[model samples]
Target: MKDNPLIKTLFAGSQPPHLIDPLALFLLVLIPIGALPLSPSEEIHLFLARTSLLIYLGLRSIQGLIWTGRRNRSDGWVTSISWSSSLFLGIGWGFLSLSWSLSPFTSRSVFLDFFLYISVYGLMTQASLPGKTVKTLYQFLVMMALLVSLDGLSQKFYRYDAYLPYLTEHPEKFDPHTLEIMKNWITTFRRISAHFLLPSHLAGYLILIIPLNVALIQLTPTLWKRVSWLLVLGVNLLVLFFTESYGAWLSLLVVFAFVLLYPLVPRLRRLGRATLQEDSPGQTPGRLLKTIPGIILLSAGTFIVLTLIGYSRGTYLWDLNAPDHPGYLRFLNWKSAFLILRDYPWTGTGLGTFKIAYPPYMLPNSTEANFAHNSYLQIGSELGLPGLLMVCLAAITWFLKGLTTLSTLSDPEDRIIYRSLFAAGLGFCLHNFVDYDVYIPALGLTGFMLLGLGGSGNAEEGEPGRREEPSPLRPSPASPFFNIAWPACLLGLSLWLFILNGKLYLVNIHINQVKKEMEQGEFEKAYQIAQKALFYDPGNPSLQEISGVLLLQLKQPERAARAFQKAIELDPKVPRFHAYLGETYLLRGDLAGAYVETKKAVELFPLRTSYQKRLEEISSLLEKYAVKNRKP
Candidate 1:
């Protein structure tokens, strides 16, 4: 192996084992902090992280080919494969939908991002690392929790966000409308977002780490370490409570109940058996009867505490129409998602098409919602019911496998670690019921890493005497071409993706620049910048729409019509494109054309008062023209 040319180039003298653990740890640390830059969107961090991980995997693939001559296996692969295959099929179907996708560019980008996530999941499972690496990662997470808690607590107490000043200084790098939206949001909510876009995002991140902190406290032998972990846990809980994320609060309660009750199950079972076997006829009733008063007191106490908490927190969970209520907004978003699923039940409108597809389905007076706010509903709306089913199956399989592995581990420390990872996974699932935490790259990566660790550790606890067979993933000697070609293709694809995302990043910068130019009343300069952006992302309907609007402002209605028509041709689902085109037709004195386009716009978005008003005005004009023509 040392003498092999491939090994020498990729792995030999490279400290391969040391590299794997550090790279994994670096990713766990980098994702949250790397997300601090507010340029473009939080998704930019995901793009950067995914690109780095993909490149790392590409290099590891070359090393694996030369040294191991086989694909690596994890303990859960047998069970995982079924669910993984289904997920791949769903993503594959998303790619296939590009043919009919309303926004093909969005569909392509989303498909690529998801495909990379799947690749990362596989790589994490295969990458070998020491058990101590997991411990190190947990410690790093604890530090992060403390740091984020400090930031959040400061914002809550001081009434100022530290990151807000930095964002304000870099106005040109982000969307002003988005910044304005956040400014308005913070004024009313008073919640802390920390380094993320929303307070709920911070809460979501904490929920993932909180369980691990609990596990660390249980596993550590020293009182000092336990107290330190307890402090970190308390900080996270305080931040979570102040953030007022009902979903996260509910999830924490459930996870805590599970963690506390899990240890008592065996004892409870023993007590039940002992009572059954007692010779005295009254023993079973006596044992049960003695706990009745305590049970009643406990239930009453719990209800009183809950009432006090709800009142102090001002959380009227039962109120559906309360202003600024998350629960009410979630209901509207979920209803919209259901409507989208009803229309596109199987294949969906297309991946990343939610923003375009959802507007028409929104409830009356609903504010614009980019996400469904429920991960399951979002997945169903974007990928359809089949995709939803596949994702659910994959999550359930991962959880069951982790639990099974935790049961088999005899070491108390190892059991605690696995149990905590399992609980973290469950928390992610539950939080997503009212939020889209899984869609956040940092949280999603953390989750996948924990799952990978759980599955890998499970594989190590084996029978003492049995010899493990070589993984079937090994390439046969007859398929030497495949061994070479597979890795080569992955490397090439990763490079291509890197370049593609870089272009998109530049395109976003240019679009933001154009917006600044427009605000300064430089229509010609704005139009020119938009033209350049369109050249880079030719299929972006939003860019096309922007170009149309700028051309209209420049009084070039003919060119504006061409741009709007092009936008509609690219993504016919958007009502705004039709309305813009109708205005251009009206400018050209084409009453029939204006009437037709505006009517289409109204049909697409019936709740848009502007579109309906335009239609009415056009109808009155047509009616007046009809009377004059009849007299002639």
Candidate 2:
């Protein structure tokens, strides 16, 4: 009998599947790029892509449970589960923190993203076979690197916004907050973001793919193929340099050092006897030696380019004392993050609460920053020490396991691939210490995908770990109730998430429309649209803030005050909510209330010049009125 249509749709066949098809892998690789849209922020794109991937993986997992007799023999479930448990526990704690989270809505969103990523990790580890998956990944990554690099070059040189076509042509669509960043591209220092939300994000993406491309170059047999891969690598490295992400640049340097030194290490060389002796034809010393001169030349050229750019921009690379310097800002952020972590040592303020919780703790002269610029510190400050430990343990476990596996590999190609993956993982971890590389969806997903591939024991062409034994076509011997119940639960959950994603998309559309209306000076229409949007996502502080602004513009200070108060109640850590409420109070002639609210705003974000200025202006007005009253 043929397999069930539902099972077929999920699994691709009745036979136990070993690997994801290249075509499907190609589609998966494109998710990060294709998810970008103009209507909402980058987070929405991440949400949509993650939701879709999770749903698809959920279906495949259900099918695996029903059709397969046991867990895939190729997947080292014990090792995988050991490391994966840490990740799960960390994320689970994040979900639990929603109850006490500074902003439950933000916590909920973060938890969902982590949940989806975990699902992807499981699906990839179970389904991917070694050779084909690596090949497919390399092909797709090279193409993506080339495409993004070209786009970045065009954007930097031609001042083009790659996302412009996705936006509506209406001038109102060009709102100051979202679209202004796109419009203001011509600065003394132009950093290309490609389609990502920031230049640093593009740098993270390039850093991730660089090692994989290096592996492909090592594996290519033909001269032209090698040259082509090298070209892609060069282009990507060039773009990465122009992104001016110091963390990414440093990470790339570390990766290059690892690759260049690996063969020279006596212990590692001893472990690679099979690759050195049996596969001598493919693993040539001359080929490896050639990379050194090229790497040196590339390094020297990069330094020269950076020096010239720094000179022209009047931003010396060594100038850390500058008020606006990224290094100085990062130092300040780390200091504040440590202070916040000290306050909540057991359980953090909450996941995704760092942005809200950090402003009040910022040092003088430091501006508002969302992330701590250090992933480990950000996680520690947001999710507490326990969560931080779990995440760290998970990463270490994956790296060690992959490195151990690489040490034992006999196949030349397999050894290279595993070494590349391990190096990439190490680079990513190192980069996170100085930058929020892991927060970027494209980079984060790619990192996890590499880990999944590394965990799957089937990377070689003739590896003994491959599942060659035939399996019975019958269903698993587990209870019929489990078989039916599990799939039904998965299907239901998938459907629910899909529905929720659609609703969220609709809400974003409505919010965008409200923004457009407000830009056109249509306060009443904007207020109505915001009210309707709030019906869908009432906890959204943004929509509430919009309603408050519109109400203030309509001369309804009482209603506006209520709106701003509601916004503050939803997310109390935001200074803008308090500032807006203070303005409303001032308009209503409630001087005492106005002073109280404005002072709260200043206390929350003392470094914000505008808030301080507003406070000063109000104080002067009160003094003038007091003088007038005394004279009368």
Best by lDDT: 2
Lowest-lDDT window of 10 residues in candidate 2? 1-10
lDDT per residue (tens digit) for residues 1-632 in model 1: 01111112336433222123445545644644554423436556765776676666566555544443433322221223222365556666666777877788777777666666565555454434444555677888778678878877877777465455756766664455467766655665566776677778888888888888887888778999889889888888778776767787777667666555544344433432222222366655665575556556555754554455456556666555677566777888999999999988988888778878886787885667668889888888988888788788877666555544544555666666777777887788788899987677666666666655555443345111112334345333434555455555556766766777776777887887897898789999999999999888888888899999999899999999999999998889888899989999999899999999999998888877888899999999999999989954
lDDT of 2 by residue, 300-390 (tens): 9657766765665466567876666767878889999999999998899998889899878989867567789899999999888998999
Would you list the C-alpha lDDT of every candidate in the order shown? 0.68, 0.70
Best by TM-score: 2
In model 1, the clashing pairs are none
Q: Estimate each model's TM-score.
A: 0.80, 0.83
The segments of candidate 1 whose C-alpha lies over 4 angstroms from its true place after superposition are: 1-20, 24-33, 36-47, 64-84, 127-131, 159-185, 263-315, 320-325, 364-367, 459-489, 621-632
lDDT of model 1 at residue 421?
A: 73
Clashes of each: 0, 1
